[model samples]
Target: MRKWLVSVLLLCALPGLSGVCHGAGFKVSEQGAKAMGMGNAFAAQADDASALYFNPAGIAFLPGIQVSLGALGILVPQTDFHGTTPLSGTPPLDTGTAVVTEHSRRDIVIAPTLYASYALENLPLSFGLGVNATYPLSKSWDDSSVFRNQVQIASIKPINFQPTVAYRVDALNLGVAAGIDITYAMVSLQKSLYSPVIDPTAPAPPFGAYEVGSLGLNGTAIYMGYNLGLLWKPRRDLSFGLAYRSKITLDITGDANFLATTPTGMGAIGLSDSALFPYTRAHASSSASTSITLPDTLDLAIAWRPTDRITLEFDATRTGWSSFEKLEFHFDSPQFAAFNNQPDPRKWRDVWSYKFGAQYVVNPRLALRAGYSFDESPVPDQTVDPLLPDADRHSFSVGTGIGTTLGSVDLAYMWVHFVDRAVHNQEMTTLRGSNGVFKSDAYLLAANLNLKF
Candidate 1:
């Protein structure tokens, strides 16, 4: 019974572990509608209020006070999975014969952002503030699906507040900026626990595998980091930009709850014998803690304008996912002390993304934009799971800007297609689900209102 309890706790903690390590894949890059329309390649052409997030230094070139309010709506279709794993079936059923097809739940997620900047009239200095949701996720599977024990539901919501200052060297056509990033995150997960051993309550011998109970966890954390940006333009028609965001460590504290499905199964066994299974309580609760390191990111880009009506830009972004090397957890309750302070190695590697975007101004009140990007997956096959089935992806976007008397309204639409992934991980046991192929895709729509005062 103690062994089963340890297994349940470990499984319950995995959502928090994997969610932070692979957050780069789920990071909300579309903080501004203009940038999203340009495939997030606007670092060099950051001319509007949203520049506070893309390239803070650009604020130094602005004329007066500006504000931007925007929101991104994301819709992910159901992800398809097919294949079999070690724990796909009961004892009598062969793993190969238990092949099955499953689909993840369809969900929509919305992330909002706000940015305000002010440029002093007499000084070449600017101050700005930004609030946005940088990491947001909502994923789930059916209760009776093959992956029920692996992950039934997982949700992560994070908010970031940034205050920035930028100085411009007009003589050298250069601008430099720095900012602090204060982030708060909340996470929740739910999954079922499975017992590999035969059920003693069964009427016959060779009792089939069954579920012990369900486990739920809720956690919250707060962390701080910094970001820096540089923008240089040697000529009127060309510009270069560089941006860096530092890493942060989040120490999370939460509580776990267990609810048994039946009173006669393993729960009754432990209740019937207290001496041998003193720690095996059917409905148990405990306090838990864990820490994870979020990776840093670097962006480099260039923008060019061959004609007054047209502009083009290209950008490359690198994420230092290699920083996520290990994960550890602790339980404050004595019953779970046996499995505390164990470290697990995660060999995630660094990855890069390339983006290209173009903008054409047709008139004073109208503009059109289009962009494309290719992003690489950071999670290795060994660590991939239903909680985060990441893969290489391609994104395409288009948008329009409408100038109004008060300000401007920008609208963008993007489609992301993830490459199919096939996994044969060694981490699978009868407790976790089997290896399989996963295919996924998503659609995003964004709108922003920019006002100049």
Candidate 2:
């Protein structure tokens, strides 16, 4: 029973804590500033070291060795939740008092990347390497937020390293690359507990109401996965690229520690902490374990040069979100013998995103870029909650760059607008008996320096 309780704690404590350099579902579309400026439409025009991530085959056509460094900073607007939700019995005020809980977030988050490429002096081959952030997501709600019973804080960070190679067959440019990812995640939530021996016969508190004994759970984990890419060029002015990133399943394992305030039943009966500490309760402390799968993605793109100074590109991506339809938690304690496999329904569906971008070169040292993308949400309206208030949206971007004797520096910015979502699910797991409207916006600034010898 003790082991079972621990498993239940871990199961409820884990969900949606992973990503890849993205699009919807905690993903970042651009790995470098140039790609950021072009709305990640560089798959076929992967000319720089960033090609290690976009399309490794393009590197086979380059000369000499190149190195690049870049960073992307996301400015997230507050995610507002105008509604009430289930609580784990953690109210800091009287039940009759009104509560005001608005939103959750941080002002800024950053993702960094590094890339290097070397073209063989006499061979039709090139080699490249890249290290970058594939996914970064962080959000924290007030301890008193309506959904406090579900989740108060969550942060997931993932990084990937890729080694790429390309071979040139006359007019054909063939490329392939593989990657390994390492991720770390943490989540904290509060749940109300009861002293059954003292109050088992008493009426249960209102559904989703907070009681005195609050259980806070937090955990951490690390895991790995691999990805590969392909690029092909049939003509001088047009090219095609494809990439497949595999799913990463995280076997998250850790320990859960419980922190309780004052017990309502204990205080009501005049008993104190010293007396309750000696009891062998299932939730006092225990080990945690669960499994989570990050989705996979397939990208198809084309880069075209219709004129000497103008270049155009487009990309279509399909994500395997159906894999997350149900999340299961495996427990290790006996307290939860009756319930072993606690399954949470995500019911997420496969989604698609499309991007288009254009670039113009005015001179040897200056260039300009612009692009746009349309993204679809995987979460259904019935399941949307403050923890993941996502909706269909669009992304617009613009950028400029300059070249010098040593290297070129590119700067780009993007604006993301999420369509307001009105959630009306009477059967929701958390926000029951309530309706909510979610509004959010975000911005990204990316910069990269490409140096060549």
Best by TM-score: 1
Where is the poorest 10-residue window by lDDT in model 1? 266-275
Candidate 2 C-alpha lDDT tens digits along 1-453: 223333333344445332221357667777888887988788878888888777666677678999999998988657876654443224432322233447775667788989998888888777878888766666676765655544566555556677767677755456655555555544444434333122212424443332334455555666676666677777778888887777877666655455444443333222342344543233345555667676888889998999878999999988888777766655454433433577766788789999898999999899999999888998888667665688888889999888998899999999988988887663322223236578888899999999998
Q: RMSD per prediction, one decimal?
A: 3.7, 4.7
**Model 2's TM-score against the true structure:** 0.84
Off by over 4 Å in 1: 1-13, 21-24, 90-97, 198-209, 262-281, 426-430
lDDT of 1 at 233: 93
How well does each candidate superpose onto the true structure, as a TM-score? 0.91, 0.84
